[model samples]
Target: MKIFSLVIVLIILFILVGVFVKRRSIKIRRIKKEFSVSNEKSIMESIFHKNFLFFEHLNNTFKEKLLTDSYVLSKLINIDGVGIQITDEIKYTIFGLVGLLILGDENPDYFPNLTSVVVYPKMYISDQRGQNKSVNLGESWNFGVVVLSWCDVINGTQNFSDGHNVALHEFAHQLDQQSGQADGIPVNLNNDYYTWKNTFDKEYNNLLREMENAEHDSIDFYGATNKAEFFAVCTETFFEKSAVMKSEHPELYDLLVRYYRIDPMKIFSN
Candidate 1:
């Protein structure tokens, strides 16, 4: 009787696994179909081309991929606006910035664990850290949520050379959090872990030193706050001030190039 019960349990488990696999397969097929068929020409022209100077620099292939990835992300992530109405322009804009980050991946996860995005008309007050309220342009929570200020998001994209992007900075934290901790180290490094750690450590220390001396630096001074913030700040510089970063910090530039799998210098140069 026990053997029969064990067999029945095994059969149930097998059936459950089969159902899960089938559902996953169906989802993937639907995503692929949506990716291929979705049209985003109007949004590309109205939102991206008009505001995002970086969009103009990308080649046609990159542009198409960005649109597809952005569309996919929009479909996957739920975005809600607080004190503002959600619009396609806003959704595509946010997703486009994220799409740029994962552009090189053959099969991007599309921030699988991201639960939702919350946008505000402008800066919002948050006391998540403690009792003291602080104004923030954006925040990425470990609970799989990202909050943003729409005004700051537009400002970041419009000024392509500013080396400051709340979207890039916050989403970077989301990437860092994927390692199960927000300690500046990201996942999928494999054997490159040591190399990444070495470079990031050296650069992070150097930034701290520069901040102490009050010396002018290409990277943001806010990076000196912590290792995680340093990684996010470096991401901002890597994309916006690629030429300056490459010229000033070649090793760090190469590391970012390898990690992101895209050379912003080449794209921006165009």
Candidate 2:
């Protein structure tokens, strides 16, 4: 009886090992398939069967079915146990940001350190004793959490052309934080820091110089406050107002184009 029991246990262990290996192999193959093909519907079909629904079902945000790279889609789906109620619309927005991050590079490890995404129903006030202590639509923590207002999110989505998105702003900070301190410089750039600094410094100084007498007619005035904030605001304008930004700040626009691997100008042109 003891010998028979041992054999059964070994069989079960082997079965478990086989199952794990098979699933891992399948995941790898699917990810590869996702990258080489533009057939997003096939991927969706795969998700529909034997998949974890991040929510009961995402409510349509009227934003047409958007598709992203396979690796990016995996990262989006992998946020399963992230401890946040990311609805369908929020997921789409998150996917959009993820797609933007990966647009520059094939890798999707943008904001790799971030783990939590807390979405509030409305704007939340910060009472942290150390910080400036102001009511904000969104906040990004270096430790790992990003807080956002749902109302602002809806508004931002509705006006995709507007250079204002709370989530996008905070996520830009998260990208900045990957290096340490939200000083606007991102880690692991394909180009040297001098290029980033020069263009950013020129634009930032221009904003400040304009503010000395009167505000400039272009970009956001708030960006003049600091380099970090300037980068975040620029990122907003980069995606939302590509054509305007390109025409207004061609150098800055070119730098963003290289870094993000996206061309909002092309978007509007098309």
Q: What are the models' TM-scores?
A: 0.89, 0.70
Displacement of the residue 192 alpha carbon in candidate 2, Å:
2.9
Cand. 1 TM to true fold:
0.89
Give per-residue CA lDDT, model 2, range 93-191, as digits (tens): 555554454554654453557766667677777765588878888888888677777778667766767788776788888888889888989777655
CA displacement after TM-score superposition, residue 227 of candidate 1 (Å): 0.5
- Misplaced by over 4 Å in model 1 are 1-28, 129-131
lDDT of each: 0.87, 0.66
Candidate 1 lDDT, 7-117, residue by residue in tens: 999999999989966775577568768667656656555788877787878898888788877877887789999999988778889989999899877777778668799
The ten-residue window of minimal lDDT in model 1 covers: 36-45
Give residue 225's error in model 1 in angstroms.
0.5
Off by over 4 Å in 2: 1-66, 69-85
RMSD of 1: 4.0
